[model samples]
Target chain A: MRRVLGVVGLLLLWEGLAAWGLLNPLYAPPPHQVLLTLYGLFQSGEILPHLQATFTAALLGLFWGVLLGGSLGLLAAFSPLFADMLEPIMLLLNAIPRVILAPLFVIWLGIGLASKVALSLVLVSVLLFFAVYGGVRNVDPRLVERVETLGGGRLWLLKEVYLPSLAAWVLSSLKVAVGFAFTGAVVGEFVAASRGLGYLLSFAQSTYNAKLSLALITLIVLFVLLLFFLFDRLERHLLRWRPRGRAESQA
Target chain B: MLRVENLTLGYGGVPVLEGVSLGVGEGEFVSLVGPSGSGKSTLLRAVAGLVRPRAGAIHRAFPPEALGFLFQEDALLPWRTARENAALGLRIRGWPKAKALEEAEAWLLRLGLQGLGDRYPHELSGGQRKRVALAQVLALRPRLLLMDEPFSSLDAILRTGVTRDLLRLVEGEGIAVLLVTHDLEEALALSDRVYLLSQGPRARIAKEYAVPFSRPRDPVGVRSDPRFGPLLRRLWQDLEEVALCAAS
Candidate 1:
């Protein structure tokens, strides 16, 4: 209840400032104006295709990036030669600003969903790769030894130890990756695309339509928040073994 | 039956154990007691095939699968429930999931952890976690059990109770045990024989004593035994002499 009030209070303050001209109405529109513009866009059905394009691209990128990055990370952990040879290369690639690759992806894959997904893939894969690699490297040696002494082989180690550890790392990274995935799609669309939130954002910027820009930004935030909520639910289901803070606080 | 003949182990070419030998007979309970870094854990690991000895022979009458080890740390996978953790060995050995869970639950009940099989390691009390770890090892039905200070983390009262319960369980199963502990009282109270290792670099067993207490000994009754006090005093004195010798 207090959280809801906090948001409302902030919106009211913004509205008061804009109404009194204490803040520039042209640059920073009030929350109510942005909400009205968003509702208008929805009612006209103009934002639907762009929203669908961006969501589809981000989802595809996330799926492929997690699958590839998680597998490669596990492989690198199990093979010393592979890790030694490929880790520096991966680090170098990761250091490159992924946003800079958006144009190149567009050039190669054209101004379509493919380019956006490819850009998002690059952004998310690097995040997930490091998450899994670090997680595997930091797995408790004692736990590995315990499994080994129980007559477990490499398969058992992967199933019993590495997978669970990697799952946690991947889940935590998913929150961060969701934003990057969205950024990748939007940025790709911004570079050269006819559809997507990023294209709409660019269109609003070119025309200096602050209301439309703010409305698009609001929708994007809401979309990312919806995705985050879903990921949070997935994390809770997967990590149910984690001790609840509520119980500890009560104690 | 298990025997380690002239075991010499080290890390990075620096000796930890020098010419150490020990034997555990069927149904025997033996313990190695020493100060921290005295290589008692190293010796136990060597026997468990986790550490390679520089020059030694470890002969076991049973296969690798028939030897269970419990580390000082519970080593329970935090993600797994008590039943799942206990069922790990059986699952790795190719038992069906349902059968493994059923057996694990049975062992949990046997270890007095009834109704807690679904709890994760973080949810369990220290004593309960220790019992769950013990169940993980015992469920494997090993002929030889190797433990590294399995109860050192618990408080005195909890430690004694768990120790007594462990003794009852292992003795009833007729399993041989080789425990490494820093607590002399724990070693003396539980074992048929105790070996004291001096401080290392290249720590060696300074002395060994046959505990004359009979089987099925109660922790309280054995501690009250007429010989318990003198035996502990003598062992402490011997340990002091070894420390003095190392210092000199």
Candidate 2:
């Protein structure tokens, strides 16, 4: 309740500032105007194509990203030679801000869903690679010994011990991965695309429609927040066995 | 039966146990009692084939899979419920899942952990988890049982109850037991024979005492036996002597 009130209070302050003519309307639209634009975009159903475009790319990229990254991570953990071969390439990709690949992806894959997904996939895979790699090391050795003494072989150990231990780390990375996925999709659209929220934002900026740009930004936040909330629910359900209070990020 | 002859165990070229030899015959209950840091666990690991002996031969005629090892910690998989954990070994050995789980549940009930099969390890109490660990191994019906202070973490009351049940179960199953513990009283009340390991960097089995207590003895009731006091005191002094020798 307090958080909602605080947000309302901030919006009221903004609305009052614009109402008094203390703020320039063209550059700094009132909160009510941005909200109205958001509602108008939905009401007219004009935002549907752009929302569809971004969602398809983000979700598809996320699926393949986790699959490929998680596999390579397992391989890297099991084989030091593979780790040595893959580390330097991943490090170089990771060393730079990854979003800069948007233009390169556009040039390579063209300004389509392919380019958008490619960019998103790269960012998420790199992030998950580290999560899974480190998660393997974090497994309890005594537990491994226990399983071995129980006559569990390597395959059994992987399923029983390694996978469950990796779940927490992977899911947490997935939360961050959601944000990166959208950043890839939108940024890829911004660089060069006919339709997407990023395209809409660029059009709004070029036309000096500050309200429309802010509305688009708000739409993206709402979507990302939805993903975060769903993933949080999933992490809880999967890791219900974990003792509470270990990590709500403080750990 | 199991035999460790002139076993020398070490880590990375540093010898921990030197010339330590012991045996546990069929249906025998043997305890290896030693001071802390005396490589008692290392010896147990060697018997379990987890550690390579620097020099020695361990003779156990049964296949490796016919043995179960209980750790000092409860060592239940936190992610699995008690039933699943108890069923793990049987499942790994190609038993049908339903049969394995039913056997696990039965073992849990036998170990006084009825209706707790659905609870995860973390949800169970320390003593409850310990019993579940016991159920987990016992469900396998291992011909040889190797325990590393499996009851050490429990409180006094809990330990006595668990130890009593362990004595009865192992003897009834006719499974040979080789236990590593530092508690003299635990050794006296529970074992047919107790081996005393002197202190280390190169710990050796300094002495062996044959317990006069008979089979299926009440681990708690036998503590009142007149001979129990003398054996306990003798072992205690012997432990102190080893400690002094090591210190000097």
Candidate 3:
């Protein structure tokens, strides 16, 4: 209830400023106008194809990113030689600004979904790779010893200890990865694309339709927020073993 | 069932235990008591095959997997429920999930942790978690148990209760045990024999005492027995001498 009121309060302040012309109308469209533009865009069904394209690209990128990064991280953790040889190279690659690759990806894959996905994959994978690598590396040695003494082999150790420990890290990184995936897709589309929310954004900018651009931006924010909320709930469900603050204090 | 002949163990090229010999016969309970940093834990680790001896051998009648070790800390996996933690050993041994869980549930009940199989370690009290640890080890049906101050973190009252419960269960199962602890009373209450290790720079067993108390004895009652005070005093004198010798 308080959160809802806070959002409402912010929107009212924005509306009051726009109504009184305290804000420049040409640069900052009113909240109501942006909402109406958003409604109209949806009603005209002009946004669906772009939305679908962006969603498919982001989802595919996220899928491949998590799979490849998580597997490689696990492999690196188990093989010291591999880690020693490859970890530095991975770090070097990750150090470079990945967004700079958007144009290169577009040049190679053309101005299509493939370029968007390839860009998003690079962005999301680096974040996930480091998260998983660190997670696997930091599992408690005592736990590993305990498993070993119980007649567990390397496969058993991986299944019982390493995987569960890595799961937590991966899940936590998923929130960041979701945003990165979306950002990668949008930015790739913004740089050069035929259709996407980012293309619409660029179109609105070229046409000087501030309300349309703001409306598209609002939709994108809402979409990302919704995904983040779902991921938060998933995290809570998976990590039910964690004691809540209230329970800890009471104990 | 286990013998450590002149065990010399260390870590990082620094000697911790020097020429320490010990034995735990079939169904025997032995405790190693020592001052802090005296390598009692190192000795236990050596016997458990976690630490390699520099120039000694440990012989066991049972195989490696037939020995269970409980760390000083609870060491329960925070992510796993009580049942899962207890069942870990069985699962590692390739038992199916249903059978492992069934046996783990039985052991939990036997350890007086009824209805706690679903609770995580954080939700359990200190004593309850200790019992869960015990269940985890005992579920393996180990021929020998190596424990390093398993109840040292508990309050005095809780410690006594856990010690009593452990004594009863281990005695009933006839499993040999080698325990490391700082508390002389805990040693006397639980073990058939107690060995005291001197402080390091090359710590070694300074003395050994056989407890005269009979089996199935209550930990609280054994502490108050007529013989208890005299035994404690004698062990304290021996420890004091070892401390003095180390100081000199």
DockQ of each: 0.83, 0.82, 0.70
lDDT of 3 by residue, B1-248 (tens): 88888888786666888888888999999999988889888788878777778888898888787898888888788789999999998998889999999999999999899999999888999999999989999999998999998888999889878888888899999988999888887888888999999988688888989899998778788888999999999999998888888888
Residue B25 lDDT in model 3? 90
Query: Which TM-score value belongs to model 2?
Result: 0.97
TM-score for each predicted model, relative to the true structure? 0.94, 0.97, 0.96
lDDT at residue A234 of model 1 (Cα atoms) = 87
Number of clashes in model 2? 0
Better of 1 and 3 by DockQ: 1
Instruction: For candidate 1, write residues B53-114 as lDDT tens digits.
Output: 89979999888888988888888998999999999999998999999999999999988999
- Supply the DockQ value of model 3: 0.70
Residue B118 alpha-carbon offset, candidate 3, angstroms: 1.0
What is the TM-score, restricted to chain A, for candidate 3?
A: 0.93
Question: What lDDT score is found at residue B109 in candidate 1?
Answer: 92
Candidate 2 lDDT, tens digit per residue, A1-251? 99889988998998999999999989989988998999999999999999999998888888888887888888898899989998787888889999899999999999999999999999898888889988999999988989999989999899899999999899999999999889889998999999999899899989999999999999999999999999989988888888776645432
lDDT tens string, model 1, A98-204?
88988888789999999999999888888888888899989999899889888889999988998887787788898989999999999999999999999999999
